[model samples]
Target: MNGFNWRTLSADELEAQYNPRKSVPDFEQHFTAWVERSASARTRLPGAYDLRYGPGPLQTYDLHKPEGSATGRPLVVLIHGGYWRGLDKNTMTFTAEPFVAAGAVVVNLNYDLCPAVTLDAIVRQMQDALVHIVAKAADWGTSAARLHVIGHSAGAHLAAMMAAAPWAGDLGARPQIASLGLISGVFELEPVLHISPNQEIRLDSAMAVRNSVTRFAPKLAGPVLVAVGDDEPQAWQAQSVDFHQACRDAGTQAHLMRVANANHFNILYALADASKPLCTALLRQCGLK
Candidate 1:
């Protein structure tokens, strides 16, 4: 083991080895419950509808429009992260309300999950979804120029990539994203080489290194808020820090925020309220009152 003392490691090491990349407790099941709870939230919020983001019939997204909205409202694209394999956009259905109620449109997106596809395919689908949404933004009644992306976990990772992605010249219609609200997102892919989740994500070190948000930080030049929950595992927190440092080092506007009493799952959940601190910050980022 290259004389490295894996056996003599500390308590953190013991925990890391036993629970590396292990998501916050019951995230999957809790999210499943949240998916069903969308109906309850919808009854109170209303104006929730499904829209097609891509040409494929299966490629659709949930767009949440608030009541009594104003002109040229900003859009918040909320990407739910489930290690790229699990969870649906429904787990994030309730998330758009805060943005919607804040006079911004909220788009909760769903890409093809894993076991049925590769991570590369998922990322491409995500990029295609964003472009398609922007193309439809005018018809959807929002300013396509301004977008505030809020992604949780895996969704955060994809958002980071989109934020830093090179201009795909052929897509046409340049976009203007205002800021990023990345919650508990994985920006660096290197960890997956040793992280068990890679078994399903299938990211080799080379691929992970190339696709890492940290590597493309320079391309992203917006105010980015990398938020995490204090009670979550170290790995979860590290991803935010590493990405923040990369962005900062690249002369981009980026900062880190931690929800004092929350964990991975509830950090994004708490943003459901229009008055929540995270939501308020997102409003501020989008230049809304």
Candidate 2:
């Protein structure tokens, strides 16, 4: 790793850095454990399952409510990441436990994967899903005004996009998102174009710039928590710093958090722990603490 210059690295070198499993040998175990844990959570938790937010077959989510009847609770929408092409919402349901226990309604959402659909289409689906969630808030016995969005990896990029979306005052009933928790997110897509994971999404320069959170001014007025893993590749971790700086440059409240001893896969696990600094900071940002 000596004399490595990320700024001048070749496309292949860049791809290697962005590919976490290549560096971390036990990456497969994380996915295996996530499925087992999430399955147990679904059976133990109480709430609605497979609520459709759009016409697409993959456009559905699981809404886990608090243990008992709790009205007027804040809604925390958790978006899963698979580089926008690889994972499901169910595997991400494990994130619902801490938030639900904290008396916050948690929605684990799914969007159509890439190669099957374009990235822009997925973004639109996320926006549509959120709008539907806000519109159907009363059905879940909660208010939409206290919505918080959290996403990891590719999902984190989408969460930032959601935060930047011009939702405020766009519709009479639209909720003003309270805060954002972007965990281990890839804020800009330009570097992704050269990465191995970009095969499915097939990102072009124009699309990369269009979706990059750092490219435009931050439209979100609420606090934003941009985080990454300390053990991740330098290029991967730099995205958080760049995005946090972009938010600050735009006069928005943003914080950069580096999770110790965590990599791309395990960082999400840290966020699932309520007492962990990552989750604690996010909970506070969402007004849950």
Candidate 3:
């Protein structure tokens, strides 16, 4: 306990570090903007909506493909983050615009949240979603061989898990992930158990260890691009740095990006802007640039 990062802080103090709303006074503004932009994205882009990857109500994704060529294009899967408790794919639908325009198929995925489902169950659902997408790439007009994944906040943790899984031909005809981008992800879940956000997540010690990307390095063939806001809390930025270092130590290429003048909520918005460094980094990782 004395050596841990949270050792000097009380439980409340620790929770505050992980809670972005506390740090960003105008957090709700971001949500409001996200919803409005998402609605516009859905209407403006040509998409396949309500595609079910599993029988669960939330196990569905909305895929936005390039205007002219939908087939054989690289696929980019975006996972939304709500601390594994709240939010859905619709809030992040706007993210697909830039990637789609760049000729990448972007799929925004949804998963059953915690307090109703365990973290591991959500991870399995994400894996299943990828498998389903890869299995049907030809039908969807995407390429399984060039699949890339992106996740923000809790979704980043899930995306890291997907990148870490041992695909090894077991996916059967679907290629291994080409790369992954984790934007403001929680790499370590142990600290989360002590945070108030953990109530919904309901993570036990073992579950925390199992879900933590920092506990062990993920096996990724391509680079792991981690982006965080410079204005975010130290813990948030540290998560990306530590996870990026862990990936490097494990022989995986990793890069850390600090988005200037952005906070947790706005950093996500930055990812949607093509001119932003974070979005460019992600596109480069996917070989779209």
Q: Which stretches of candidate 3 lie over 4 Å from their true place?
A: 1-4, 165-175
Tens-place lDDT digits, model 1, residues 104-219: 77788888776677777677777787788787777666887778888888888888877676556766654667788888887766655665566677777677777787777844
Which clashing pairs does model 1 show? none
Q: In candidate 3, where is summed lDDT lowest over 10 consecutive residues?
A: 166-175
**How many residue pairs clash per model?**
0, 0, 1
Better of 1 and 2 by lDDT: 2
Candidates in order, TM-scores: namely 0.86, 0.93, 0.94
Candidate 3 versus truth, CA RMSD in Å, comes to 2.4
lDDT against the true structure, each candidate: 0.72, 0.83, 0.84
Candidate 1: segments with Cα more than 4 A from true spot: 1-23, 55-58
Top-lDDT candidate index: 3
Candidate 2 Cα errors over 4 Å, as ranges: 1-7, 165-174
Q: Rank by TM-score, highest first.
A: 3, 2, 1
Native-to-model Cα distance after best TM-score fit, residue 181 in candidate 3, in Å:
0.7
